[model samples]
Target: MPAKSVANAKGHSAGFMNFIREQGVVGLAVGLAIGTAAGDTVKQLVGAFIDPLVQLIVGSQAGLKAAEFTLKVGDREGVFAWGAFVSSLITLLAVAFVVYAIVHLMKLDKLDKSKDK
Candidate 1:
């Protein structure tokens, strides 16, 4: 390639990097990755630790991941599958709690403490 072309390419790359940094794209990407991992961790924690405690109390299946309710009327049977919704709610709660704990520990909410006064 010509020297001018090489220099132009280098300039473009540097400009792109500068734009990314200035726009906080790198921080946003890192935050997204960490949020995904934290969600996975919360799922594992709920499944392995919290679910059993819940099961023991409710006398139901672990995490309520499974439940069946059947009704019979006029020779017809109706089935309701509430388990999936319950499990999803549990997961949401777990993720929220984990996020809250992380935020508390990191003191991210304290950034405005001085402003409040």
Candidate 2:
């Protein structure tokens, strides 16, 4: 019984390793790290470059220069930070474009390979 259990465990471990190998673990890890770094870089760019450009276009009061606005709700008043939302939207668009470009390139490469064969 003990020997059978040991063999089963070994088989399970081997299967798991085979699954990782088929999925290209090294490539997956490198891509994930690079993508995360790129996202952070984009966020910074939106905050630094896009924010100022937007502020210049919309004026100091309506744009990035004014980070928040006051809203009145009956007897209560609240502040809304719209600049952060603008920055976040810019970052999202940048990341989407990057991913789209990558996928487009990959599809082109695949087509080229099929043509060669």
Candidate 3:
């Protein structure tokens, strides 16, 4: 009985694999490869361009310095690094804006095609 159950489980796993194969494995692989490359490109852009621009606007002190501020209340202490938080927030916003612009343009192109039809 245990052997039969194991065979059934193996058959189910094979069926799932076959289902994924039937769903255009080549296209999925190509899409994943392109996505990984695009991610790397964006990382470079953020590191080289966005980081510098943000540092300029937020001031060099905020960009290069990471100081811990301690808050004490009745012998309890909490430390915070405000500069690191600011830089991270700025980077997040810049990346989000770039993604939004790309998606918006793609949507506009789709709308334009529908209008033409």
In TM-score terms, which candidate is top? 3
Positional deviation of residue 44's Cα in model 1 after best superposition, in angstroms: 3.4
- Whole-model alpha-carbon lDDT for candidate 2: 0.72
Ranking by TM-score: 3, 1, 2
Off by over 4 Å in 2: 61-91, 94-117
Give all candidates' CA lDDT scores.
Answer: 0.79, 0.72, 0.76
Pairs with backbone N, CA or C atoms under 3 Å apart (clashes), candidate 2: none
- Tens-digit lDDT string for candidate 1 (4-29): 99999999999999999898898789
Give the alpha carbon lDDT tens digit for every residue of 1-117 in model 2: 699999999999999999889987987898899879877876676667665665566566354535889999999999999886775676577567656676686785354354245
- Clashing residue pairs in candidate 3 (N, C-alpha, C atoms within 3 angstroms): none
The lDDT leader among the candidates is 1
Q: What TM-score would candidate 3 get against the native? A: 0.63
Q: After superposition, how far is residue 80 of candidate 2 from its true place, in Å?
A: 11
How many residue pairs in model 1 have overlapping backbones?
A: 0
Per-residue C-alpha lDDT of model 3 across residues 1-117, encoded as one tens digit per residue: 699999999999999889888986876898799779877877787888887887677677454458568899998999888767767777788887766676686785353354245
Worst 10 residues of 1 by lDDT: 108-117
**Roughly what TM-score does model 1 have, to 2 decimal places?**
0.62
